[model samples]
Target: MRITLERSNLLKSLNHVHRVVERRNTIPILSNVLLRADGTALAMKATDLDLEITEETPANVEQAGATTVPAHLLYDIVRKLPDGAEVFLATTPDGGTMTIASGRSKFSLQCLPEADFPDLTAGTFSHTFKLTASDLKMLIDRTQFAISTEETRYYLNGIFFHTIEAQGDLKLRAVATDGHRLARADIKAPSGSEGMPGIIIPRKTVGELQKLVDNPEATVTIEVSDAKIRLSIGSIVMTSKLIDGTFPDYQRVIPTGNDKEMRVDCQTFAQAVDRVSTISSERGRAVKLALTDGQLLLTVNNPDSGSATDELAVSYESDAMEIGFNAKYLLDITAQLSGTDAVFLLADAGSPTLIRDTAGDDALYVLMPMRV
Candidate 1:
């Protein structure tokens, strides 16, 4: 294969595909990326058996052919090249060695037969839909932080995406939880998305998809089946195997009987939590919140370190309540709020607390209280 492309173009394509290439793999071809040159474009593909990404970039093709080379090495070489430099790539007839040259620099990399690369087959999709990039970003950002990292509960290690009826309107929802805290966000479901089966999108795939939709103006096409999920943005395509497990019914975890209410400035609450957490040395970093009429007190105590206390004016008219929570969890939940005020719905000192952004009803968070 012989192709010529700009250094910027080569680097951009490499950056998109190399992240999927496993650094250490038992199979030799899995560690390499396949480069196929045809007509006016060069297609670069990388896969780790479970997930695959392919990106096509414009190139001047001297001869149409394909080859496989070390993904990381080629990415590094292209990244270090001068900007706007013309990159030349050629492979030998036997496909044993690939040469990459730019200006005064030249490097030879070992190549494997492109035939050895595995193909990821995405079976027929049962549902396909379109989503604006900004809405997709909002869905991920609001819930991804709560995804469980515990491997044993594999079902909880991803975001549960599905459609549901909310106030007579169909909405697309993303929910994630790690047992201690839960986050749920929703957006208007696009046309043809009705009756789509709920699916758990693995954490790694969610991360990769987030990278592709950084441009708010872009539109992403989504295709899903029982076993796989596919996302396409412009000339880039990503396919990932969905987690084959059922997510728990998250509705049961959200507290509905909570009657105590407190409204506080989101920024003030987050800053207070951050400051008080410094004195907490326990594993949970527990912080105590004392609420009363028109006032809220934040405190942390650690036998090994010290104690901290801060007070903020809040709009609370319910019975006085004191609750304990993980400072980090509180900060994470508060950071998700896009509004100036965060509303807290409390049942008691022992029950889970419901949090919401005053700006919208489409997002909610639930946190279990710790025994302080």
Candidate 2:
């Protein structure tokens, strides 16, 4: 195969697909990316058995053929090449190596037969829908942080996605939890998404999707089956395997009886928590929140180091009480809030506390309290 393409075009497409290839792999072809040159385009594909990404870029094809080469090595070479320079790629007759030439720089990379590259076959999709990039990003960004990293409970490793009837409308919801904390976000369900089966998108796939959906104005097409999912954005397409497990009923964990409400400036409360938690040890990052009539006190105790305290005026109309929470977790949830004020709903020192962003009702969080 022989093809000529601009360095910029090659680098951009390579950057998108190379990340899906693992750095280390037992299978030889898994370490290489498949490149195919056809009529007027070059298609590049990379996979790790679980996830696959493919992208096509316009090119000048002198001959039509396909081969596989080290993905990272090729990307590095193209990245270091002079900008706006035309690149020439040609394979040897024996299909042993491919030559990369641009300006005066040249390199030869070992190649594997294109037939050896594995393909992730996406079966029939049960549902297909389109979502604006902004809406999809909002749903993923809010809930991804709470996905459980524990390997034992494999089901919680990815965000649970499904359509549910809520507030007299069909809503598409994303929910994730790690036992200690839970995050849930929702958007109006798009047409053709009704009655779709709930699916657990694996953690790695969710992370990759988050990076790809950067253009807020663009539209993304999603196709899902029971075992796999495919997302197409512009010239890039990604297919991934879904987790084969059942997600727990998350509604049971949401607190419904929390009566105490405390409203505070979101930025002020977060900064206070950050300052007080500075004296906390890595293992013990709990920060105590003492609530009274119209004031709130934050404290962190670390016998191995020192202690800290910060107080802020808040809008709390409840009896005096003290509750403890993980400072890191609190900061993470607050970072996602959009409004100037954050509202906390509490039942007791030991029960789960519900947190909401005063900006909207689309997102909510639940945090389990710690004993101080």
Per-candidate local distance difference test = 0.94, 0.96
* Tens digit per residue, CA lDDT, model 1, 184-273: 999999987899999999999998888888899999999988889999999999999999999999999899888888999999899999
lDDT of 2 by residue, 1-372 (tens): 999999999999999999998898899899899999999999999999999999999999999999999998999999999889999999999999999999889999999999899999998999999999999999999999999999999999999999999999999999999999999999999998899999999999999999999899999999999999999999999999999999999999899999999999999999999999999999989999999999999999999988999999999998999999999999999999999999999999999999999999999999999989
Off by over 4 Å in 2: none
Candidate 1 residue pairs in backbone clash:
none
Clash totals in order: 0, 0
On a 0 to 1 TM-score scale, where does candidate 2 land against the true structure?
Answer: 0.99
Each prediction's TM-score against the native? 0.99, 0.99
